[model samples]
Each structure stands twice: as C-alpha cells, then as structure tokens.
Target: MDERLKTNLNLWNAMVPVHVDSKGYRVDKFRSGENHLFPIEREEVGDVRGKSLLHLQCHFGMDTMSWARLGANVTGLDFSEKAIEAACALSAELKIPARFLCSNIYDAPNVLSEKFDVVFTSYGALCWLPDLKKWGAVAAHFVKPGGIFYIAEFHPMTQVMANGGGVAHAGEAKKLELEYSYFSTAMREFPPGPDYSDHSVTLEHGSHEWMYTTAGVVSALLDAGLQIEMLHEHPVCCFQMFPFMVRIEGTRYWRIEGDPIPLTLSIKARKPL
Candidate 1:
C-alpha cells in the first residue's frame, strides 16, 4: 500500500471506536429498529429483501447491518482492520448476521469472490478513493447480472467549497470561506480533533480524501458497463454540510436558504441481464 493510504488506514482504525460511540453514527438507534438508510436512496432502489448486497466503504458496518435488518443478505468491506473488527463485534453482539472483510478496495476481489444482487455505496464514500474508474470497476464487479448498483452522494459542485480551517470571519455570515480551488487534486490534511459524531470530544484522524465532479461519477459508472436506470438530484442534503445551512423539519434534512441548490445527488444503475 502507498504510504498515504497506510496513514489513512491507521487513522480510520483509530477512529472506529469513536465513530461507533458517536451520535452521528447513531448505533443505538440502529439497534432499536431505526434503519440507518436514508429514504432517498432506499425509495429509489426499492426492495432489497432477500437480495445479496455488497457495501463498499462500509464504515464499521452500521449501515450494512441496517440493510440486513431491512432483509438483505449483507457483506461490508472497509480498508481499516479495526473498523472491520469493530463491525464484526457489533454484528455478533447484535446477531445481525452479516459478514465484514478488511481489505483495500483495490484488493477486495482477492479475498472474496461472489457476485451480489445489489452493489451499494453512499454518502462520503467516493471521495476517499482516488480513482473513479477503478472504483466503478470494483462496484460493477460485485453486481450479479441483472442486479442494481446504487449511490447517494454529495454533489461535486458542493465539494468545490472548503469547509475546514475553523472559519473566516464575515460581518453577517461569519463562517468558513473557500480557500482552495473548486476543482483540484489537493488531499486535505486535518489536525487531530473531534470525530464527526461527537465534536465536543477530541480524537485523531490524519486522513486524505479526493473530490470528483458529479458528472465524473456518472461517467465512471457508465464506463464500467452499468446501464443507467434513474438519476436524481435534490435541493436538500441529509447532513449539515455547511455552517450556514438550515435543517428542515419532518424531512430532517438540511437546506441552504437561497434559491435552492443541489446538495446531494443519487444514481441507480443496473447490471445488464
């Protein structure tokens, strides 16, 4: 593995416990019958019952197990061994009946050899990978013929904006401003700090991520031979991606109080029959 990848792996391993304990992950709710999946992705793909599902970049397997709760036979893969271990422990503890494998995405095929009825991935997953083409190929590789592959992710247009470095003060909207280009191959570096679930508590995550245009994502998946079924973009996001965003009730989604912009994008594609 590349040194950068190894470094990121170490950080994710260290973060597994914190993530499991964080409110953002809501592990307790998942145990209490709260499905960790968003309606946007679920409704679009519809009905995974009894289907074999492969979830790539499945962090600690909460969502993967949630899919099992929804009636999909699930397998999760993550680069961090600790994350996989934590996920396996959680599965055994909860009796979720899912499998987890710890391997780099590029090498996952070497360890596991089975096609799935659904190849699934979602939010904040694509950016961690550096190559979209390879990522798409991996996803397509796992899908059985006539199965579906789905992704719900933050739009690349939104990714161009910078969210880190505390914030830059403005007179009215005093928050972070864009310090980097909207389209660049710069891997962001963060200091040791709080995990997303519990920001008040300090943790360490020295990791790297990459950005891709929404079009780039679509192109890559298409290039991998999946036939497009449905693609949708919504004005609201599932998370508070920006400091200036507001949460909408009932929906439990965040919205920018402007003329409305695309916050997240979802695409569902099918493996050929």
Candidate 2:
C-alpha cells in the first residue's frame, strides 16, 4: 500500500474505539436492533430480502448488519482490523449473522472471490478512496451479472465546504464557505485531528483524500462496464456535513435549509446479464 493509504488505515484504526462509544453512531441503539440505514439508501436500494450483499469500506459493520436485519446475506469489508473485530463481536453478540473482512477496497478482489447479488456502500465512503476508477472496478467485480450496485454518498460539491476548525468557533462558524475546489486534480492532505463521529478525540495520523466531480464518478462506473440505472440528489445529508447545517428535529438528518445545493447523491448501476 502507498504511504498515504497506510496513514489512513492507522487513522481509521484509531477511530474504531471512539466510534463504538460515540452517540452519533448510536452503538447502543444499534445493539437494541435499530436499523442504521437512512431513508435514501432504504428507498433507493429497496427489497434486499433474500439477496447476497457486499458492503465496501464498512466501518464496524453497523450498516452491513442492518442489511442482515433486513434479510440480506451480507459481507462487509474494511481496512481497519479494529473495526472488523468490533463488527465481528457485534454480529456475534447480536446474533446477526454477517461476514466481516479487514481488507482495503483496492485489495478486496485478491482477498475475496464471491460476487454478490448487491454491491452497496454509502455516506462518507467515497472520499477516503484515492482512485475512483479502481473503486468502481472493485464494486463492479463484486456484483453478479444482472445484480445491482448502489451508493449513497455526500455529494462531491458539498465536500468543498470547510468544517469549522475549533469547538469554540464551530457554533459561530455556521456559514457556507468553500475551503476547497470541486475539480481539484490533486489529493488534499489534512492534519491529524478528531474523527467526525466524535470530535472529542484526536487521531494519531492524518489522511490524503481525493476530490471527484459527479461526471468523474459516473465515468468510472461506465468504464467499469456497469450500466447506469439512476442518479438522485437530495438537499439534506445524514450527518452535519457543514457547520451551517441545522438538525431537523425528530429526524436523524441535517440540512442547510434552502441552500439549493445537493448535499447528498445516490446512484444505482447494474451489471448486464
């Protein structure tokens, strides 16, 4: 693996414990049989009952287990061993049968050789990847012919906004400001700091993340031989993506309230029979 990817892996390993305890991830609720899937994903990838599913970059496997709860035979893969361990423990404890593997998305094909009925990944996943084309190929490789591939992700446009820097300034910094570019041709480096699920703890390593245009993501899937089915954009996101986002009461979602920009995007593609 590249030095940058190794750095990201270490950072993720450091975050596993924090996420297990973070309220945002709702580890407690999930343990009580709450489904962690969002409405966008649930609606977009409907009816997982009796299908085999593969989730890429599944952090600790809450979402993967959620699919199992919905009756999909599920396998989740991540690069963080700590996360995979937690996922396994959770699956064993909850009696939700799932297979969790610790492998980088790029190396997934070499480690596993089963094509699934559904290839699924969601929110905050794509940014961690350095290569979308390879990511697309890996996704395609896991989908059986006539099966589906789906992703619900933070829109690339929203990724350009800056999350306010410090806790003291975060509440007051609720304005939409572009700190990065959407079409940047280079990977951006970030300093080590708090994980998003729990901002209280700092990471031991920083990460390198790439930016992609919607066209770039779509083109990669096309190049990977998947036929595009649908692309959907929404005004709200599952997390507080920007400081300006307001939590809509009684829902597990946040929005910029009339910002008129796509905060989230979902795409469904299929492998031809």
Candidate 3:
C-alpha cells in the first residue's frame, strides 16, 4: 500500500471497535435486521436474488451480508484486517452465506480470482482509493461479460468544497468556516472527526483521503469498456458530509432545503456483451 492508503488503513483499524459501538453503524440494529444498504441500491441493483456479487471496500460487510440475506451469492473484500475480521464474525453469527476477504482492492485479483455477475461499491468507498482510472479498470476486470458495475457515492462537485466548511449555528455547535482547499489532491493526513454516534469518546488519528471528479469516475469506467447505462444525480445525501447539510426525505441529506442540486449520484455500467 502507498503511504496515503497505509495511513488511512491504520485509522480504519482503530475505528473498527469505535464504529462497532457507535450508533451510526448501528451494530445492534444490524443484529436485529437493519441491512444498512440504501434504497437506491436495492432498486438499482435489483433482482440480485441468486446472482453473484462482489462488494468492494466492504467495510465490516453489513451491506454485503445484506445482499446475502436477500439471496445473492456474495463476497466482500477490504484491506482492513480488523474490518474483515469483524465482517467474518458477523457472517458467522448471522449465518449469512457470504465470503469475506482481507486484501487491498488493487491486490484483490491476486488474492481471489473470480468474476461476478455484479460488481458493486457504495458510499465512502471511492475517497479511500488513490487512483480512479486503475480502480475503474480493476472493477471492470472483476465482472463477467454482460455483468454490471454499480456505485452510489457523494457527488464529486460536493467533494471540491471544504468538508467542515459551513454556516454559523446558534447553540454550542461549532460554526462552519471554509478552512480547507477545494481541488482534487491526496490528503496526507486528516485529524479524525467525532464518532458518528457519540462525540464523547473522541479519538484522533492521522489519515489519508483522495478526490475524484464526476468526469474522472465516469470517463475511467468508460475507458475501461464498461458501457454507461444509467447515471442519476440525487439532491439527497446519505450523510452530512458537510456542515450546512440537512436531512431530506428517506435517509437523504442535502446542503440546501427545498432544493435539488445533486448531492449524491449513482451509476450503473455493464461490460460489452
């Protein structure tokens, strides 16, 4: 792994326990049957019943297991051993017929060689990758001919803004200010933010991240020979990636209320027949 990825992997390892306990991950809810996949995926990747699925960057496998629960023969991969371990444990407990592998997305072909009917990745997956074109090619390499590659991620336009940049709040909440850059570049280190659930048990680690514009993602996949099928821009977001964002309908967040400006986006592509 490169220095940037290595740094973030360490932070993700540290986050495993914290995230498991955090309400945002909702471990207890998952235990009860929450299935963390968003509705957009459920619909976009529809009819997964019995098809093979390869979920990349499958952090702890909640979504992967959910696919298994819905009847897809599923395998999930991630570079974080801690996350893979946790995913394996969850699979065993839930008895979800799924396989979990610990390997970097770039190295996965060497570790596990199998094509799938569906190649899928979801929210928060892309930023972890240092290379967009290579990532897209790797994704294309994993799906059988005529199979699909699907992703629903934060809009790259939204990514160009400062993460913590926001407007003022009235109460004790911290005020929003533009303190970071707005261009595509690798983040060498990020001070860990608050736990998604509890802010009290704070932890900080030097981490890494990257950026990919909308064109970067689409063109890469196209260059890799995945035909563009559907691309939908959503006004709602899955998380409050920015400070001024507000929750809209059905688990979606947005920077502005009563306005739709593509905060989230989803794409479906297929290999040539």
Residue 115 of model 2 has an lDDT of: 97
> How do the residues 1-273 of candidate 1 rate in per-residue lDDT, one tens digit apiece?
987788788778877887788777778887787888888887887888999999999989988988898899999999988889999998999889999998999888898899999988888888788788998898998999999899999877677665632112112353435566666767766556655555666655566778787777888889999998998888877777776777798866877777245778999999898
Candidate 3: RMSD over Cα atoms?
3.0
lDDT by residue for model 2 over 14-67, one digit each (tens)?
889998999889999998879999988998899999999999999999999999
Better of 2 and 3 by TM-score: 2
TM-score of each: 0.91, 0.96, 0.89
Model 1 worst lDDT run, 10 consecutive residues: 164-173
Q: Which candidate is the best by lDDT?
A: 2
lDDT of 3 at 27: 83
lDDT for 151 (candidate 2) = 93
In TM-score terms, candidate 1 sits at 0.91
List model 3 lDDT by residue over 88-157, tens digit each: 9989988878899999999988998899999999988888888888999999999899999999987776
Per-candidate Cα lDDT values, in order, are 0.81, 0.88, 0.80
Candidate 1 stretches greater than 4 Å from native:
164-179
Q: Could you tally the backbone clashes for each prediction?
A: 0, 0, 1
Model 2 stretches with alpha carbons more than 4 Å out: 164-171
